[model samples]
Target chain A: MNPNVPDDSAAASRYAIEAVAEITHVSRRLIVVYCQHGLISPVATPEESGWLFDEEAIHRLRHIEHLRTEYGMNMAGVRMMLEMLGELEQLREEVRFRRGG
Target chain B: MPAAFKDYYTTLGLSKSATEVEIKKSFRKLARKYHPDVAKDKKTAEEKFKEINEANEVLSDPVKRKKYDELGANWQDGGGYRPPPGGRAGAGHRADGTPAQEFHFEGTGFSDFFEQFFGGAGRRNYGFPSGEQEFTADGGAGRARRGADIEGDILVTLEEAMLGTMRPISMQTADPRSGKAETHSFTVRIPAGATDGRRIRVPGKGAEGTGGGVAGDLYLRVRLAAHPDFRPRGADLYYDLDLAPWEAVLGEQVIVPGLSGAIKVRIPPGTASGQQLRVRAQGLPIGKSGDRGDLYVVSNIQIPTEMTDAERELWEKLKVASSFDPRSDSKT
Candidate 1:
């Protein structure tokens, strides 16, 4: 209930790359490729493990795969679209914040 | 939350150390003065009324008040809040902080600060108006009405969003007639391509409806986890590409790291600080589309705070030979 107290959710659930692949139905190779393109990132450190993904990364991976397969969009094009979408989301958020929402 | 902070105490006309009674008294006075229904300038009065309500809403509640006091005192110390070392950037969205009770609501008129900080907390004090009930007693069959809609945050991973998933939500409400608590669970379907702030609605899954009426829908707002390395501004991902003086002026191939391998990007000669080196198709995917965004490498030219003897000697030699004067453009 105390906001000053550090929340427990800070140590959130993180899945390894393999588990994320299983969850998202995205192949490990494609996931790694996405990582190479900087499309998605793993939260794990080198000393810790190969790759660890949180929920956000997993969602992004699925979204990436969906675009690749469903829309037939390449990585570069996908990146542009994503950027524009992200910008739109940001503006919406800003308006909400300004309005005290 | 926005960078601009609101002083709730000032809005409520109170000192930092005001008491609960004084807060209530002030809120009552302000409410009477600014009540939109009675005011000449209704539009302005409405804004004033909402402001005072938010002020009172936080100051009156103990938990919210404690959090505000901490932030208020911390802000007075003069610094933007930077999380302490190894704190995981502690994204305290409090997503799972969904109250187990059936106090669902919507359009409560909260500011960004209130929603960001004490958002996950229950707003039970905003008692339901009897007028909101859809039915009235007709001296016949019992009146029935739909329950208030529920709103709570759901922490969604990108993986789940892309694949579509069912998340379980449970609510316990006191049975009005029996006066006993009853718990019920429902699945909230998060569709594929669901993005942050998108609400996943579970039809007829909110608080129990009165007299066998249909239940209201439960709305779970999606919130994504924060990334440590890259920050997303729309689809474009931004990374601070740190560079040394020589690298900035002379240009060099710098190694930018990723999860699996490092990307060697060619930094052009005479590259200025803050210049963006964009890598195409190196960001996130668009909504249900094949379009991806670009990754922007924002150059940050850093000078070594401490230098070794040989490094200092080399810098001194370069300084003697160099024609560059950083302050040349300055008019002052």
Candidate 2:
């Protein structure tokens, strides 16, 4: 797990796809499928060989696995859930921003 | 986790023999009924809608449907589902009543069942068996794999965050292997000068090992709760210090509420409204450097809306005596 460096979040350490595959216990092929579905994005998508993933994407992948394996949701179902959850999160953020400190 | 057997077939008004197309059709029909936009009773409809959606989620997928069917083998004869005689227990205990012995972890947002049976690509198109599973081709045990890490969120008040505190947090998830919900509780010590959004790692407190392998770690993410007196920007604190118009113009010594305690700050003479007064090192701790970021006292000046006779006379005297015209400086 990576530490939360809010200032240098962009410069945070990244992991290769193979490392991510090992961490999530998911196949590289399935992770590519998830990318095709736009479920999660990579920190860097380089030419030919390697793609890098950060902590956020990894947590998201684990959540995806949790949704599928634990909650019994298919890709379509998981996609819908993610969309709804994302929208809900966005709404909450908007409310919090508007609320102000 | 489904504590009681929910009859998805009955919910959809379809039998076990219902085809895929029929399941879709029934789902669409009921979904329309409790669609939230069209439902008559909004409250009950919302709950009913969730039930309908859950039922559809299970029945629509072929693999999930198969698993659900297997779990509910005697759905027709069942009032409550007893754990299949010795099915899941086989993972932890063998046929000879010997403990097969695997690992367990108290994860943040997943069921223990998933961590046990389906975790790490048990039944997916993801290559094959698992990335970390220690099993041989002939169904024999192999090398042990380290347990997966667990992540969780914990709310920290700026007060507690600055001084550093240890908090006890407990995570509860359903354990399908034992057919019970398990709760694992532990205390996490947050170091002083902990930054917001930073993760505090508690070593080896994550999910248990798989096959006598080393256990994983638990990472607790700090979510700083909103404070009433101050707004933290990194280690710096922002305080809205309200002042009267006279106080803004003449300046005043005021008490600024610090994270640790009340701090006194002097508002410089001729301080204008919206001017920021900096109190150095009065904010929260910055990292582990033992230094604190500054506390900014933002001036919010207020003028009297309703004036008494005495105050109105004083204002009238000042208005005529003062030659200060702010509009002379600009063309707007």
Candidate 3:
């Protein structure tokens, strides 16, 4: 697959870079980076030109905002911090993943 | 007037013996914390602010407080208010010429009674010549007292603050000139780079004076709305700009977001997450001088989550090609 080609799954979802940027105050590039770094995962498929962001993505962004603004964490520190947070999330998710709920 | 309130003593948590300076110091500290605009609880904060203002009003002036303290507590719970003698003064006269001075009811303001008894500098309606003489001698005559400064709050985003903005604020005032309450609307111009606690004064926007006095000034205390990306400390602004893993490894021109818009910033090769770069004079502007604070950009590197077959092959080739260990201290 060509890396530059747009994904098809995104066509079904509604959020775009501009929409999330308008709401989150974070840039499109940063949101993409957050997705790339596993701090947040894109819930929608890349069927179209833009990816759709869900409420969970927005919640994650708010958590990131609290870290940067209140705790004064840089993105690198945020990355490391997310790793620990991910561990806790995974532990909780294991029970749900097992129950298929 | 049954009795007057002990607001001054209550304000300082002190007795009447508390010195004037002590009362002032206590007021300043309490005002900073509970001044409705700063307090967290809106309703209670406002009430506390008014209470503090009332307390300060009495404590700041000797005569008002003295008259206030002289009246006993019976004036507050709704019992001892008797209007002054004479058909016009509301004074209760028991067929005696002398002023019947004992108050009999409650719930009137201690400040109100002081102003009534002392005549508050000028109100020529009453026939008491003695009240007039005392009012005139006590720095009350020929004094052009400035109107009490009024405060308000305005919340705006960092973007609005950066370019400067003008917002219309609504306020109500009892105009002394007209003797009627009027709602006034006016646009308040916010200076670029204004900080919280920075007061903007609008002329003739405050409470008007009595006896043809000049109107007071309105003061606006600014509050910065929360932003998702940018953080401001003092005059400088900070932002975290994200980069692809390749962009961090190889130098690139990345788009950096700002309060107003986006700008291109060059990232040096081998840039790491959390590395900060400075953009000078892009933050808040200095007051009146037109100079600005710096904007600090911190780099964030993002790694790709999944790889295609060909991408996986390339990554496998690169993984063996480089010996860089991300975690050097790992015991495993």
Tell me, by lDDT, which candidate is best.
Answer: 2
Write one digit per residue (lDDT tens) for candidate 3, span B1-332.
32343355776566777777777667667765775445799778645654564565566567666756655432435555433344333232223343332222111112334334432222221111122222234633555433333444445446556767666555544432244555566666666777643545555555443345565445444544334356666567777787888888898997877655677789999998989889888888765568888888888787888879999998899999998988987947
Q: What lDDT, from 0 to 1, does candidate 2 have?
A: 0.63
Q: Report the C-alpha displacement of residue B297, candidate 1, in angstroms.
A: 2.2
lDDT of each: 0.59, 0.63, 0.56
Order candidates by lDDT, high to low. 2, 1, 3
DockQ scores for all predicted structures: 0.02, 0.04, 0.01
Best by DockQ: 2
- A-chain TM-score of every model: 0.77, 0.83, 0.63
Which of candidates 1 and 2 is the stronger one according to DockQ?
Answer: 2
Taking every candidate in turn, the Cα RMSD to the unseen true structure, in Å, is: 19.6, 17.4, 27.5
User: Of the candidates numbered 1 and 2, which has the greater lDDT value?
Assistant: 2
Residue clash pairs of candidate 2? B104-B208, B105-B207
Worst 10 residues of 3 chain B by lDDT: B122-131
| Best-to-worst ranking by TM-score | 2, 1, 3
